[model samples]
Each structure stands twice: as structure tokens, then as C-alpha cells.
Target: MKKNDWFLAAGIVIAAAVILLLQIFGSVQNGLTVTVSVDGSLYGTYSLSEDRQVEINDTNRIVIENGSVVMEWADCPDQLCVNHRSISRDGESIICLPNRVVVSIEGTDGKNEENSLDGIAG
Candidate 1:
């Protein structure tokens, strides 16, 4: 093949790889958000389910209860919300970085809590 052809092929391959990575990340999860609010102050962000952090340090010292929703995981350096924990009820989630994903528990698209209890939904 010509040199130009090779270069073009390589470019296309690289572009395709980047697109695939984005798609995969976008589909990483499908949950809800549960923002944490301190004593009249806005905390960080978090997602439902997943074993993430709810607060950063003991400076504020906040926590969640039976209420199911997003919880911020403010410990990791990167702080990217991983699969985190797994929520199924009305509120439950994981958090990281400066984000806060919330889980509907009733399904991301709005199905029902029972449906999402198992794990990732369809």
C-alpha cells in the first residue's frame, strides 16, 4: 500500500479506538443522583448504589440513612465514580471526584425499585 494509504488507515484506526472508549465510558452505568447538603451548605456529589464516599473529611461530618439516593465518594485521588456500590431502594449510590450521580432505584428510565435491585438494568 502507498505511504499515504497507510497513514490514512492508522488515523482511522485511532479515531475508531477513541470513539469506542467514549462509548464504553458513557455506558459505564445508569443510575440516579443524590446530592449531599451540609448544615445549610452544599456538599459534593455522589451516585446511587456503589461503595463510594459520602463526604470528604471530618470538617463537615455528614452521613446518609434509610434514605436512598446519590452519595459522594470524596476519597479517591482521581475521584471518578466507579461501579462503586449498588443501590436498589429509593436511595443509594457511589460518588467520586467533584461529581454526584443519583440512582432512581425505581430504574434509571423510571421502571421500579424491584427492577433495579438485581444490578444494572436493561
Candidate 2:
């Protein structure tokens, strides 16, 4: 075998071992934290839990309540934005795209984020 081939094989083996170790010990997952800023102003930070809703006003005032969160009210005309639903998982979010009102669930940065958001993966 070429000298470079030996190094490549060793690198591959090391990578596999590390992956196996992570699986055995559980992969390190970054904690989830959410901070809401509405209309470029500081809204609030919310912790993850089931059946929780956070309501915000145009003035950036926020209210947190337990239960499925829905669009209680909005200043926008047509009231189309308040018809949206609630989110319960890490990746789930409700956004009034037209109103620029965004509610996002924070999770592991990249891989499996959507699944986490959807509450599919425990």
C-alpha cells in the first residue's frame, strides 16, 4: 500500500470510532432557547413546552398563556393573520407572512431541524 493510503485508512477508522462513541454516549445536542423580537423590537424569550401560546402586540408587549396558541387578535385588516394556528415543537412556527409577524421554534442548528420543529422526533 502507498504511504498516503495508510494515512487515509487510519483517518477513516478514527472517524468511524468517533461516530460509534457518539452513538453509544448520546450525541451532544445544544440546548434550545427562543427569543422573540417583533417588528425589530425585543419581544421576549420563551421556553419550550406543550400547549403554550404567546401573544404579542404591535407595541411589542407580549403575553404568555398556557394552552394552544392561536391568533387571538391582530391590528391588520382582513383579520387573515389571526386565523393561523399554534405550534408545540422545536421546529414548529406560526408566521403571518404578510404582517411580518414571525414565531419560530429554535432547535439544533441544521440537520433534522424541521423534524424537530414538527415535534416528530422526541
Please tell me which predicted candidate would have the highest TM-score against the true structure.
Answer: 2
TM-score of each: 0.26, 0.43
Assess the local accuracy of residue 63 in candidate 1 as a C-alpha lDDT between 0 and 100.
40
lDDT of 2 by residue, 12-101 (tens): 998778655544333222444344656656566665444345566652222334522345666766666566665443444565655666
Candidate 1 segments exceeding 4 Å error: 30-122
Q: Where does candidate 1 have its weakest 10-residue lDDT segment?
A: 97-106
Deviation (Å) of 88 in candidate 2? 0.8
lDDT of 1 by residue, 2-114 (tens): 99999999999987786655434333244554455444355555445444445444422224444343333344356344335533343333434343323223334444344
On lDDT, the leading prediction is 2
